[model samples]
Target: MSTSTARFTHLNPGFICENCQREVQPLKVGCRNHCPFCLHSKHVDRFPGDRDNPCQGLMEPIAYEFNGKKGLTLVFKCKECGGMGKNKAAHEDEVQADSYELILKLNKPKS
Candidate 1:
C-alpha cells in the first residue's frame, strides 16, 4: 500500500457511534475521527489521527469553535478520563440525521 494509505489504515476507519448508537462510515474526505451524527469520538488518539491513546473513553462534544475558512471545529471532553480533544466538523455532519439541529441547540448562547 502507499504511504498515505498506510497512514490512514493505522487510524480507525469507522465505528459504531457510542453516543448515538449509529453505524458511522469512514469519511470520504479524511479519517473518521468523530461521529457525524452526535459529534462524539473515541479517546484513541494521543496525537491527531495517531490512535495511540489507551484511554478507550467516550468523548462528548462540549463546544465548538469557528475555524475561519475551514469552518467549525468541535471540542470534545472524554467522559472516562476527562481528557479533551478537537476535530473539524465534517460537512456531512450538517446533514447527518438530527445532528445539525442538535449542534445548533448545543451552540445556543448562554445567559
Candidate 2:
C-alpha cells in the first residue's frame, strides 16, 4: 500500500460525512462513518474475513469482489489495526455495491 493508504483506519462513531451528509449508525450495518448515499467505507483491516484484530481502527473498503453465487464482497484493511477482513456485502449494501476490482499482488507470507 502507498503511504497515504497505509494511514487507513476504520471509521468510528461520528456524524455522517459532511460531503455526503446523511444519518450514520454502527454495526446495524457498520455505518459509523461511511455515507450510505456515497458508499464510502473506511480502511481498517489486514486480511479478508480475519477479524481477530488488534487494530481497533477504521477499515476503508477499497472495492467489492464478487464470489460465485456466494454474494458481493467487501475488501478492507485498517490503518491503525493493520487487520483485514472480507464480508459478503448484504442486500442493502448491494445498492451501493458499485466497486472496481483490483488484482493486487500482495506479498503472501508463509501461512
Candidate 3:
C-alpha cells in the first residue's frame, strides 16, 4: 500500500516494545504503555492518533516539560521518523523510580 495517500489514527496497539519488552497500549486514552522512567513510546501512531507512517521503530525519550501543578512528564521523539510528542508519567512505571533516584542523588552526602 502506498503512503501519503492514506491516513489512519486509531492505534492498533498489539505490538510489544522491543526496547522494554512490554505490551503496548491502545490508542485509547490513559494507556501510557511506555515505561514512565524511560519515556519510550512505540512508533505506532504518526501524529498522536493519526497512524500513518512507514518507518516502524522505537521512539525514545528526547525531552519534556512542566507547566504547574500538572505533574511529571517527558517527551518521545522517533529517531526513525522524527516525530515528537509529550506524555505524562503514570504510576506503576519506572518514572517514579527515576524520581526517587533523582532525590537520592541530590541528598547523597557528597562522597
Candidate 4:
C-alpha cells in the first residue's frame, strides 16, 4: 500500500493546541481541524480527517474569506513546508466554535 493509504486514519479526536496549549474538544458535527481559540492547526492531514501528512508543521492562520455557501473560510500557511490550505470556520458550532473575533481580525482589507 502507498504511504498515504497506509497512514490514513479518519479521525476527529480532541487535542491540546500546540500553539496555545489549550484543550480542544472534538467538533459536534464534523472534524475539528484547528483550535477555535487561536485558529491554529497542525499539518497532519493530507486529506481532511485523514491524518497522513508527514509535514507535521504548525499552520498559522493568515487570512479569512466569506462564501455564501461555505460561510467563513480561514486560510492557513504551514510554517515548516510553506504549504497553504483552507478550512471552513466553525463559528456556529455548538461545542467549540471558532473565534469570531479572531476571524474578523484576519479578514482585514489588504493594504
Q: Which one is best on lDDT?
A: 4
Q: Write the per-residue lDDT of candidate 4 for residues 11-58, one digit (tens) a residue.
A: 668999999999999887767889999999999877776778899999
lDDT of 2 by residue, 13-85 (tens): 5455443566545444443334444444444233432233454565555555666786555555655565555
Per-residue lDDT of model 1, residues 19-99, tens digit only:
889988776555667887777888988888878799989998888777667676778899999999987777553334326
TM-score of each: 0.78, 0.40, 0.53, 0.85
| TM-score leader | 4
Off by over 4 Å in 4: 1-10, 109-111
Q: Which ten residues in a row have the lowest lDDT in candidate 3?
A: 102-111
| Error of model 4, residue 98, in angstroms | 1.2
Q: Number of clashes in every candidate structure?
A: 0, 24, 4, 0
TM-score of 2: 0.40
Report model 3's TM-score to 2 decimal places. Answer: 0.53
**Between candidates 1 and 4, the TM-score winner:** 4
Q: Compute the lDDT of residue 48 as modeled in candidate 3.
A: 53
Whole-model Cα lDDT of every candidate shown, in order:
0.73, 0.45, 0.53, 0.85
Instruction: In angstroms, give how far residue 67 of model 3 lies from its true place.
Output: 2.3
By lDDT, the better pick of 2 and 3 is 3
Candidate 2, 111: how far from true, in Å? 24
What are the root-mean-square deviations of the candidates from the true structure over C-alphas?
A: 3.6, 11.3, 8.2, 4.2
Worst 10 residues of 1 by lDDT: 91-100
